[model samples]
Target chain A: MKEERKKIILILLISIFMLSFCLLPVIYMVIISLSKNPDFLSAEKTLRFTLKNYFDVLSVRSLHFTDYLKNSIAVSTISAALSVFIAALAAYSITRLNLPGKVILLFFVLVVSMFPQISLVGWLFKLMAELGWINTYPALILPYIGWILPLSLWILVSYFSQLPKELDKQALIDGCSRWQILFKVLFPVALPGLFSTFLLAFIFAFNEFMFALMLTADHKARTIPVGIALFQGLHGEIPWGNIMSAATIATLPVIILTIVFQKRIVQGLTRGAVKG
Target chain B: MLPKGTEKSKELIEAYSFISPLLLFILLFIFVPVVGTIVTSWFKATTFLSEKFIFFENYRLLFKDVNFWQSAQFTFLFILVSVPIELFLGILFALVLNCTIPLRGLLRVCVLIPWAIPAAISARIWELIYNYNYGLLNFLFMKLGIIPKPINWLGTSLGAFFSLIIADVWKTTSFVAIILLAGLQVIPEELYAQAQVDRADFLQRFYRVTLPLLKPAIIVVLLFRTIDALRVFDLIYVITSGGPGGTTTSLSLYAYKYFVGGDFGYGSALSVILFLIAFFMSIVYVKLAGFSKEIA
Candidate 1:
């Protein structure tokens, strides 16, 4: 009983530490966003709560905060959907279609994933410039799809491999083409895996910074991260409240997705990183 | 019924067709850019200047450049300092989360919150938290009497370095924990029960059973975190902008500055150097982790 009590106390203490360590900055962000004075923690001032920061951030047309949000949503959604569909095809081939050099291909993709973004951004900048596609959605979306493919492929491959080979055999015997087996038969059963991959890929594409920073010239193609990063006050003073509010809003979609699909995200992340 | 050789070849063609789109995207976007960077490094490829072939000149300049060396040094030190701390905290969090604790799901969601948010956005939040007068860290430290006055977190070199470290840790420890938690879950309960039967205490069990069993996962986390840390850009870019005398500029950011300035040759050269380092580290990782063998 004493030992169990000690263990319980230990677990509770660590849990508290984990919660505070993970949450305090996020809480601080929200607090500053809501406060009229960002310097409320100073000796004389206190938190004077208001919704002005959020109102200014959202309603102010010049800020282009909503435009950034819209671009981010559109870019990330398209990139994630296309990346997953393409990776599913490749993964289907690797797992079921007896593709030659499939192992080599997987390793190649893994190596590509580790290549630093700096290595690619310079040339991509020139390419986008030459194509006259700078500050456009396609400029960001195409690279994002490529960047996201490896993780999607890895996760889906693992998920697909786990499903019995007999499913493919049965589908093949039904006079189904390879394409039909993948789309009509396999996809229905792998819906959860597909959703998980889509979620992870969407988060990745949404959070991507270097690509968006280099590819997009302005708010027309700029996503939220770049937008929030470059958010400056019209005057010299840093608009803490407005920046925090924008950040808070920007984080909402990903935060909600993560919390709701916490288990699926964890599974997909582990499958991509560790299972190999 | 066995298919004929031509039929087998036809299936191969079909399989290749399925994989072609993915291959094409990666080849164009990733592979071509990488090769282009490599090729451009051998030239005087500035925006205003005429492109001229100047093989190895940029690299020679890089060798003699002070800022390049400083950024390289900072990048290495940042990796050395931050990766170990993240690994340690990640293990602790993973161990806690692995236990049958109350609010386990809530604890997980809290952990995932940091990892979920973009580093660029979170660094802005950290920027506020590390503010001189009204920041959370300074205010708390002063109230607790840990320091006499608010330190300029992003103003001094050491302050900026550690500031970036703290923010990076906060943003990434969740990832390490998640990866390690997957590892911890795969650990058999029987081993712990057996350890208990052998009269092993908690610490003993962790050292003897858990550590040994979790080696592969630990290795995976270490490699992933190290490679990721080596390319540290977004957090430092936002928080300090490599300020306080460029003390915290990573190789990636340093190269990015050149790219922004339209000096693609030097930028590509810098990128090539970073790519080589990362590539070398990955080779070591592949060998150490035996990834190929495991997948096969």
Candidate 2:
């Protein structure tokens, strides 16, 4: 009984210590997000609840919340859809096909995707300027594909390899061409991978800041994360309440995605274990 | 059945055909850009550099750049400081979860929240937290009587770097925890059962069984953290823009400053250096992990 009590006590203490920083800090952000005045930051009083931030941010004409959300939704959705489609098709081909230099191709994809985004930001910045592609969706979209391609490829390829190969053979025997076989047989088998990759890609694209910050100069191309950052430096003093609400609103999609995909999260965790 | 000889050729062609489009995209996008980077590193090129090669001046200038050196030093310091702390925290957390703990899954996911957000977004969030005026950090410090005044966190070098470190630790320790936890799970329970059976203490079982089994995962976790940490930017850039005297300028950020400031040649050279550093560190990690002997 004593030993069990000690174990429980230790676990609770460790959890509280861990929570105080990692999770509590985030919770603190939420609290700040909900508070009315900036002065509440210094308030020691408990449960000083206010909905003013939420009301102000959710107001469409108020602080560009509507604009930011729209851009984030449009850009992230398109990016995700395009990436998953491209990645799935590619992953299917890489796995199902016995292409020449396939081994070399796979290795190259791994290195390319892992190529630090910060490394390419310069070259990309220069290229975008030269091509007059600055502040455009293509600027962010193209890079997003390059960034997420390797992982999507890795996941779909691994999953595709494990699938029953006879499904493809049967499709071929039944007079289906290669494209038909991939679209009909292999692609369907790769649904879980497709779903998860979509969510992952969307979150990544939405959360991207550096490229968005540099490439896009205005709200037209700006997504929520970049928009939220810029909101701080704009229009006299910082709009702390609106910034918090915008961040909270921006964070909602991912939180929902997390809850929905909690089942596959474990599988993704183990399979995509950090690759060197 | 189809004849064997013709069938093999057809199979090979079909495979090539299937993967060719994807291959072409990879080549045009990834391969061309990387090659462009290398070519630019050798040539004195601007954004509009459709001109001649000036081999190694970029390399020469980069070699003597003082700010570049400071950035490199700061980057190395950031990694060396942050990676071990994150690892120690990660392993410690993993040990807790790996043991018989209640609400394990709930706790595990909570740890992943910081990681799940983009570094850029999280950096901005931390900016609010670190804001000198109307910032929670200063508010707490004042209440606790830790300081006489609100410290200018994002306004100073040490302040920015420490805040960045705190954010990163919050963001990524879960990555280490999950990886280490996976490693922890693989140690046969019977070993622990027998250890307990033989009257071994918690510390002994961990030191004897867990640590040795955890070596490879720990090495990989260290590699991941160190590589990412050395390239730190989004946070610093968004928060301070590497300001208050460029104290927060990382090697990658310096490379970026030159590149965006339109010194493509010098930026590319710096990039080449960063790549080499990452490659070298990864090789050291692989060697320690004992994955080297298996390499071709």
DockQ of each: 0.81, 0.42
Which residue pairs clash within candidate 2?
A: none
Specify the highest-TM-score model's number.
1
Q: B27-115, model 2: which lDDT tens digit per residue?
A: 66566666677777898776555645889888888778889888888898889889988999999888887877677777777766776
In model 1, the runs with Cα more than 4 Å from the true position are: B1-3, B293-296
lDDT of candidate 2 over A7-49, digit per residue (tens): 7788788887776766766676677788766556654645466
lDDT of 2 at A178: 82
Residues A132-180, model 1: lDDT tens digits? 9999999999999989999999999899989898998998988899888
For all predictions in the order shown, the interface RMSD in Å is 1.1, 3.4
Give the number of the best model, judged by lDDT: 1
lDDT (tens digit, per residue) of candidate 1 on B1-296 = 66698889989999999999999999999999999999999999999889999999999999999999999999999999999999999999999999987789999999999999999999999998899988999999999999999889888999999999999999999999999999999999999999999999888999999999899999988998999999999999999999989999999999999999999999999999999988887777766766766452
**Each candidate: RMSD to true structure?**
1.2, 3.2
